[model samples]
Target chain A: MEKENIRYSELERLCKEFRKTILKIITEAGSGHPGGSLSVVEILTTLYYLHLNHNPKNPFDDKRDRVVLSKGHSCPALYVILAELGYFDKQELHNLRKVNSILQGHPARVYNGGDEVKFVPGIEVSTGSLGYGLSVAVGMALGFKMDNKQNLVFAICSDGEHQEGSIWEAIMFAGFKQLDNLIEIVDYNKLQQESRIDDSVSLEPLKEKYISFNWQVYEVDGHKISELDTALADAKKYKGKPKVIIAHTVKGKGVSFMENNVDWHGKAPSKELLEQALKELEGK
Target chain B: MVTVLEYKPSREGLGEALLEIADQYPQLVAIGADTANSTSLGKFAKKYPERFVNVGIAEQNAVGIAVGLSLVGKLPVVSTYAMFLAGRCWEEIRQSVCYNYSNVKLVGTHAGLTVGPDGASHQILEDIALMRVLPNMSVIVPSDANEAKVAVKKSLEKVGAVYIRLSREKLPVFTSPEEDFVIGKAKLLREGSDCGIISCGVMVYESLVAAEILEKQGINCRVINMHTVKPIDTEAIINTAKKCKCIVTCEEHQVYGGLGSAVAEVVIKNYPVPQRFVGIKDKFGESGPAEGLMLKYGLKAQHIVETVKEVIKYK
Candidate 1:
């Protein structure tokens, strides 16, 4: 794989911009998941701007690599990058959860009369209910392998989503089938919506769990753009087994008060809180 | 005396249909949730080994994968026992497949009371109700083996989600192999004026037999095969209500949300008519022979005949 021409400084700058925009939208919408959105800023920024082989013009091109945001509540982050990359009009971002908006609260395709009329261009599948997106990604990878295509499928799941039994079910199938084309990146922010993973249901042996299921595991600092870029590039080349990058990140990365806080997991910031959060992100 | 018909499980027709249409639809793929042979998807797996995927007892993953495969231009057919496929993975089917409008075919074998000896745990009496409720999901319960084959093949021709319910028991094969399957088009097997018998799945055979017995008793009954539960043949249902003025719904499922409720919805709205239902009256099925269970659940020909007489009095 060729190196992405963008420098680490440029990627870091975009992460700050993404964090501010994510908080602003959540505040405007009056309800959205901000903690998980802030957690995966660098990971998504690196993938969309640097790593993924996608075109904003031909979003559904057959040769393009696919991405499934399994932890869909953090879609404010995804929506920002997609709009910046011209997947849809940037103005549509304001109508995030409003009725008749194409941007659903979760990642989804708009369907009318049982027909898909419109959808956010970059979103590969409609997902909100956890534990199902990995299976969908595995299916896509298997389909690509069947057709002898080289396109890869990336599935981004939250650490809390690993609690779903279907995630392991998909992992088992991907490993058994030797789907080297499927890469799963877990946003390991430690905290779920109500509490931390340690206080609630603990997924302590998470790394060994994937290895036992025949997956090649890689752990990295999720906020580090270069590390995520490296792991993503290597996972793309690794063969004979599925790959999962456990991305360690804070609940809210740039925001001072919201960082590591469980209450920010799904709550939108008020205007006063939003201004303070944006001030914290201004120079970072 | 009614002649004994050749018996064949509806799952067999599903297998035959896959083989029949495999060459034409080269992108056709079969996915099984560890019950490949039981659901008769083994036939497709045997011939097209590369195209077959056994997800290994994970019904939710099977549905999610089927949706994924559909997104990438493959016609993925996923089958498992009805209880697991429809009951366990209902939300997956709704969100990934139907709500996404993925072109996936879901085949639920061992449906209704015909899945004998497994008891209520394995038999799915609520699949029709469960599947029919989802938007963009077309639910089809074939009357016999031949119609099951047509339903499977025809369902693939369209570009949306479809749920085909098949029975595990070796049922009497009465539907013709030559008949064309049009979705939402009910087949009126016998025309009569005394009363109408609307039925689906294995109970269609029972309804036909019941109509025969009613004819001998000078009470002619109209027997209809209401195969497609969703996108129901409302015209057939309304016309039957007008012609007969009385209706009796027969099904090998719970009387609540299966063919009985569907027919009643159409009848009571379009043309109000007196109707009676012949099915399991909200009870779990116990372990027994298929024939014995049908008798105990009041889903046999005799039960349909009795229900028809009961509804005619209300007319």
Candidate 2:
């Protein structure tokens, strides 16, 4: 019921609140990737809640579409989304990366609910080593296509991760297969963990590269819920080519000091910074 | 259990069996690199055209795609030569498939020196050792068409990542299709007391023939087929060691970390016995015909018979 356009005004509000949640969770835990997590909240919120024909009750229902988080370092956003969908208790969000907790520093395969206490549902493959998820998603799309099952596969990749060879392999492969079902969303947060992505290794002419790979490439503001939704919807409408949405997102969008700063990439917010971030996002 | 009457390349067996698997189990799929015909996965391609992936000479892509299929719950059979699947794409196998512990079957054909005329490049004698080293990998090297057929059936049930290293040459049939071919359990072909000869893949036939020769010489030797090498059937090897007090291991692979090494590792862990390895040594095999290499590299039945006598003397 939470369609993208209907929640336009509320989208910004939800994003701000989600940013607060990420910061609070990370700061309480003393370690997390706040920058990319805050940046990806709107996209994650849109995909998990609005779209994705997956059951919160029966997670392993084979027909469900898949989501592969290529940039797994930003698991703060991923785990937040998983918790939002009632994968586990919201109270359990605070126990991330602690001893014996399902949530590790990186997302791992964990069972959800009782009876079907199996598989790492919600997460297709535990891909902490970046750049591998796209190929894996492509494999999934091909499998579904083979089975004649109408399922969409959404692979979330970071702009920084474009440097990896595995991603290009997936791109070439998807293009060859002409798999219109697979969707690749680029969280184009300019900052990498070390430096700005462009400064480190310029993925310039990125659109041209994808277009050369025969992908139906689209560009959008990752945080603009309306544009993100339209891009994803339009992707589904287009036929005969795999789609890639280059979402231009600021690194750590909602928070003040964290935005556009490379230092905030993998570093969690401090106590003072967390309060400040919350105040900025959740203003009464 | 589907009955396969004719003896064909297990890759050919896959070529015939894959589409059936695809039709029967919606989860069954394949990824190949233009080697479908060579690997005998073409029948699978024709039946379920959409289900088969042709990565176009990219072995790494083929492997990566298999990993992806595993994540999405499709049991993918990667069709490639043993040389490329385990040799060229070793990193992909390590990082993607085995690292994640996916339910994938890497169908590696053209294994061992028997892939003659194609020269040493196509021959993959080291694949068994390479695959056996990886944890969570079930290494199944079927002896003949019957065993290969059984392996094809059993690999589907075997858990985690599996590597089915098949011979390129069309081998003679020995076992009945109705026989039980469990992945880790070795099959005892001949029961004898004087000495025990354990072998896998194409070499099992040689061991059996050698056992016959040993019988003529009044040396009643035992021949056991150690198909699944990674989870070496230690009980079988130890029993053979206890029964004969000496062991002669045979394989088309290197003596190190292969079927022989795997059995040796197990036997040495439990009880040390006078063991003889009839396999390729540290040197690379030269370009020759199938029979020539087997004869030249001490891989023949006569070699096994001779080794059994030597091992018996030591025992």
Candidate 3:
């Protein structure tokens, strides 16, 4: 793998393209999450383009770093990234949420048509229910450590999922085990499905909570690639304790009307709104 | 004739079996939810500290972590109480282990009402039902200590999600060391002509005792250890139904979705027969002596004998 230097201009352009691709698929699917998907674009773009050590052709490479979309409802963003990386055909993006499509509502290993053999390999694990991906990531990191491998396990979880008790269980276990190779990025858009996270269930002093659990915590501007790059780089160098990046972002980023709107959490854009979103992203 | 060997908890057998096979399968790992001594995983933890992981009373995390470990070419055996493992971590097991077809072995100890003085809160009577419903899951209820050891060994070699239901109380070893243990295969304990008693777990011992009482009364009842609950031995069930003309299913679990329900499903679909279930009714248990709870919950040999007699009348 070639070491690519961080370029903010190129990442900014890629982030716009990712948001456009997400809008295209979610609108085509008729019912998909646009808010969280748009919010996670720059974070995912920075990881895939700059930080993650992976190969588009050989996804099953043992030494490759892994990224688990803990907030799996935002799979339109992940599906677009995987398609761009040649894990599957880019045209399959239109078939999102359709029966027999590799891209299901949640991220899952794709099966071939006739024999039902699992062929699409980029997906690490199937995650839809909240609060499961972090523990799975901890397991992977522990396995890599046991084998003396340098591979890192990164997981992106939602702000609302923090309310789940199991998420705290994972946090406590990762801290006690001292899994320095694991990194958790919270897409803290402040809004859950029903309402704002603070109104529903407050996670105030969230960084303090992670610190109490012995995690090295960092808060970053989620939309800015440069800040995310620096935070991720710093997290990689830290030893002993696991690291968490609370990426502060807007729910529906890059779009005018949907920004911070809880209604867009799971609803797809209307035909007119889709056209507007595409125009805004294209103008960027 | 039944051979009564020294009694041992099925959980101890599981621990010993893992120790026996640890050298062969170097990639095998043991995970516990702070119940190492209770689940008999302390032996493995003592011998191989590096391979053992104590997730600290978190059953859901234990299951999810096992799935992750299995993905990286390591076989993980996760241990916890039956109620917590099958109830609390059910969705995690369904999504991470069963859905992904991960090679994760889930050992649920303290299964059924035999958990004794700890009472209904600790007892788990619905684990069999919870595990058998999953698509890629294999459910096993070992009949005794010897069978539990073999079941653990077999689960390690098989490459998919498996749930092994073990007992906390010491059970008499009815199975011989020479007996072959295979997943999804039923072991026939006694041969008779009037009726057949199909049972699993500790209930198998009571079924054997019931067969003896029935034999003295000129009612010859065959005894079958139907240990593998999922992918049940449908052919054995059908054949027994044909030979006996009636069936009596027994288990130390709820009659609704446990061994009895599984047997009825096979019998109704393949070969319909007049049947009766000898297990707990739809009611919770309370704190009591193990033997008293077994008798009160209708899980004893006398209950199996009565059920056999009633079902044989239909023949």
Candidate 2 deviant stretches above 4 angstroms? A1-6, A23-35, A110-117, A191-196, A199-201, A252-284, B1-10, B19-23, B67-74, B88-102, B117-121, B133-136, B157-160, B283-286, B305-314
Regarding DockQ, does 1 or 3 come out ahead? Answer: 1
Interface C-alpha RMSD after superposing true interface residues, each candidate, one decimal: 0.8, 2.1, 1.0
| Residues B1-315 of candidate 1: C-alpha lDDT, one tens digit per residue | 334457999998888999989999989999998899988888789999999999898999999999999998899999999899999999999989987879999999999887999888987888888988898899999988899999999999988999999999998898779987899899988999999999999988888888888899999988899999889999999999999999999888888888899999998899999999998888888888999999988998998888888889999
Candidate 1 Cα misplacement greater than 4 A, ranges: A1-6, A111-116, B1-5
lDDT score at residue B183, model 2, on the 0-100 scale: 81
Minimal lDDT window, size 10, model 2 chain A:
A110-119
Each model's C-alpha lDDT? 0.90, 0.82, 0.90
- Model 2: what is its DockQ? 0.38
The TM-score values for the models, in the order shown, are: 0.97, 0.87, 0.98
Predicted candidate 2 versus true structure: per-residue lDDT over B207-310, tens digit per residue = 88888877888889878998888787889999999999999999998888788888888888898889989999876777888889899999999999888988
Model number with the top DockQ: 1
Candidate 3's clash total is: 0
For residues B77-103, what per-residue lDDT tens digits would candidate 3 score against the true structure? 999999999988999999888877788
- Residue A92 in candidate 2 has what lDDT? 72
For model 3 chain B, give the 10-residue run with minimal summed lDDT. B170-179
- What DockQ does each listed candidate score? 0.82, 0.38, 0.76
